[model samples]
Target: MTVTFPHKTLPWLLIAPQLLVTLIFFLWPAGQAIEQAFYQEDAFGLSREFVALENFIELLQDPYYYNSIGVTLVFSMAVAVSGLSIALVLATMADRIIRGQMVYQTLLIWPYAVAPALAGVLWWILFDPAQGPIALWLEYMGIEWDHFVNGGDAMILVVIAATWKQISYNFLFFLAGLQAIPRSLIEAAAIDGAGPVRRFWDIVFPLLSPTAFFLLVMNIVYAFFETFGVIDATTAGGPGQSTKILVYKVYEDGFVGLDLGGSAAQSVILMMIVGLMTVVQFRFIERKVQY
Candidate 1:
């Protein structure tokens, strides 16, 4: 038996609130950013002049902007790969456990409740060169871990913090995906003399492809945007802007430097980049990712 909405007005009314929110929150701000990108205004907004593409032109010539782009790409890939890989392993182990699985899952998932900035702060404390326990241990190992002075160390710090926060989210999805796989498939593989590793690669991994693809896209987006808080808290885009991902650069320039027009241009560029990534995922990657 098929059921449909009784009234046309009811369906529209049901979705109107969500549509209104999207328009107000996303579309409206995006429009403002585009408009602002084409104008040059004083920090206090006392004077304004239209200067189309000038901000973008300057950004293109800025070496630091290029550096930020490179940082963003590296950070996004690192966070996504590390977070997904860690989460998948943990989820697989949890799924295989016949006992205390609930306890393990609860512990794994609770990290998701921590705020991104807080997570960054926690890592900062752990890696603080002066008093951090990890830093002390690293010193004992003859490896210096001062993020305050080393660009590479700063990047590693932020990446670790971001990945740590996201692992819980990826774990939840992967665990669900693993559980949805049929046990009969594995049993059949076992009967065929396949070991656990071989069965996982042949059956379980292929079945989990869809979930992995979804997480990849999500983790990329999170690294690009949501990680701003983590980077800001941990490194303030510092050790000479090495940790400055595009989103953090946008914030640093707009709020701290008060370059509104330039910041708006950067935001527009970022939006285009994210749109292109999404298109690429659907056009190319999505086709190859099994459903």
Candidate 2:
């Protein structure tokens, strides 16, 4: 049965709220950022000068900017890969539960409901060099764990916080994808002498390509943009700028460093990078998706 609106304007009315929100939140801010990128302005906005591409050129020449780019790449990849992999494993385990399924699933998904900053603070306390239990355990194991002065440790800390925050969301999607696979197919594969691993690799995983692809895009975006709170709360892009991902750099420059024009330029670049990444994923990666 095909249901159609009697008037063409009815469909527009149904989507008007969403369109209004997009305009107010996304498009308006994006336009402001773009406009600001072209001008050098003081934090107080007392003086301004139009400097076409000067901010961008300065960023290109700055070693710290390059470092931020590299850090962002590593952080985003670690978050996306580890978050998806761990979530997939957890989802598989959750799907196998014969009883208390909802309880287990709820526990797994609880992390996603936590605010990003809160999640970062939770992990920050867990890995505190002085009092954190995990840090003490690592010390007992002869591994030095200190995010305060150690750059590598700080990177790892932020990555773990970001990945942990995203796992529940990925798990929900993965569990749904796993559950959607027909049991008959698995039973047939089992009868054909295919083990659980074989069946999963050959059938289950391929069927999950669509969900994985979608999560991949979302995770990358999250790592790039939404993890700012996580970084700020935990590391503040500290340990000599080791964990300063691009988005945090925008905040650091704009709000803290008082370089509004440079910050806006960075924001514009970050937006373009994410846009290009999404385009590339759909162009190349989607080709491998089964559906």
Candidate 3:
């Protein structure tokens, strides 16, 4: 006897719970935030008036808002590129090794397991002025180390912390992509007198584009949003708001400053920027992908 299955109803049944959760948790909150962005609020988070676009206009006119936008862009790009480059290099190197490969892969990817907050604390321990090990070492070595006095130091520390935390994730994806390539293709390229560098650029690189693209998008999102914990722990939006990215500013405005409407406006701006970036990236890369 053969069994019959109602495929359409089963699929919907499986997806119903997920759809309901997303609507309740994600869609509802997003709609509320969008609504809040346009409304004025009182001290108790009560809606006082319909401000209708005023918050958005204020966000655009404010210099601090513009500065936060610039900081967010710079931090996101720096972290994404540095993390991807380092991860790609490490993944390629690991792909060439033969012995104890799993051990090395495990060790290299272990940092991805660490929470961003924990990683931020570790960086704080390393870079904290007057108290950190690096600070003490610099003092002993007669080298002045002052992150607080230097804006560049703060930016560099944030970039380094973000990149370090994300590199392992990118490394794992790249390694998987590298391993998926057929050895026969590489052998053929080598037989046709393709050098290692030539093979990499012409063959391996193109094949790995999908993986690179995936990581690029994920890295941008992570750097933009998830790195807030790291930034908060390390600098708390800094000695002079030097390290305050858009999301950090949003958090500061809503939670610390008690300006929920303003924070919602900032959040709306971030969502717009992220949405634009994603659309532009997809349009740019979709054409380049070879089927």
Candidate 4:
């Protein structure tokens, strides 16, 4: 029923369109960033000067840059861990529901469809110190909930927003993985006198490791780069740069500060960091992740 292209040249020709798209869209932009990183151009683009490694050197020397790195590391870990753990728990509970399973899945997954900025706004409104219901309740409890000036509070707010936004996505994957697992295994384990907790730990959890590992990597990457809109719409990396993650810093420096070279250098550095992290994950984590 299907036609096969046996010739290598034919296969290449068949995939040429996708290859061209990748080259034009991904490779070209990456190349431009690398080129721009080594050059400093005037704000107006009237003058351009080559300054090899100077931008990177300055970033290394800047204390704020280090602060951003620390903030990003903390933010990424918080987002990834919280999101994945909550999603997994929800998925497990959903799997057990004999009734209203579809309704529950739909309710859990609908949040992922919301735009990042909108999600951030929703959380922001919920935590707004002046009018937010949660904030009012916290105030009643004698805890002053103001992320405006408190660095730790700001970090927690952003982390909560990011984690909430990401949970729906991780939930989707985890639910799918749970569904794919054979029901026979759980039954057999029960027959072997394995209780619910033992059955889940020994059977279900092990089988879901692949999906969990994949979600872990994707969640980290999302927190690193994709949560820019969330941060921008909610905190704008403000409160004295308390929640200024690396990507937000890049945007602030390049677009607002007009430091094109510095931003490009930051972009390049981020690419390298992400690449190294992927490599490390695939090397070590992937081993523990069963197929």
Each prediction's TM-score versus the true structure: 0.95, 0.94, 0.91, 0.96
Best by TM-score: 4
lDDT of 4: 0.93
Q: For residues 1-291, what per-residue lDDT tens digits would candidate 1 score against the true structure?
A: 998767979888899999999999999999999999999999999999999999999999999899899999999999999999999999999998999999999999998999999999999999999999999999999998889999999989999999999999999999999999999999999999999999989999999999999999999999999998898778898988789899998998899999999999999999999999989988998887788
Over 4 Å off in model 2, which ranges? Answer: 1-15
Ranking by lDDT: 2, 1, 4, 3
lDDT per residue as tens, model 2, 54-130: 99999999999999999999999999999999999999989999999999999999999999999999999999999
- TM-score-sorted candidate list, best first: 4, 1, 2, 3
**Model 3: per-residue lDDT, tens digit, 1-291?**
998886868878899999999999999999999999988888695457889999999888989888888888889999999999999999999999999999989999998889888888888789878799987897899877777877777888888888898999999999999999999999999999999999999999999999999899999999999999898888887768679999888888898898888889888888989999999999997678653
User: What's the distance in Å from true for residue 192, model 2?
Assistant: 1.1
Q: Which stretches of candidate 4 lie over 4 Å from their true place?
A: 1-8
With candidate 2 superimposed using the best TM-score fit, by how many Å does residue 4's alpha carbon deviate from the native? 11
Across 263-290, the per-residue lDDT of candidate 4 in tens digits comes to 9999999999899999999999999877
As a TM-score, model 2 comes out at: 0.94
Best by lDDT: 2
- Displacement of residue 9 (Cα, Å) in model 2 is 5.7
Which residue ranges in model 3 land beyond 4 Å of their true spot? 1-14, 135-144
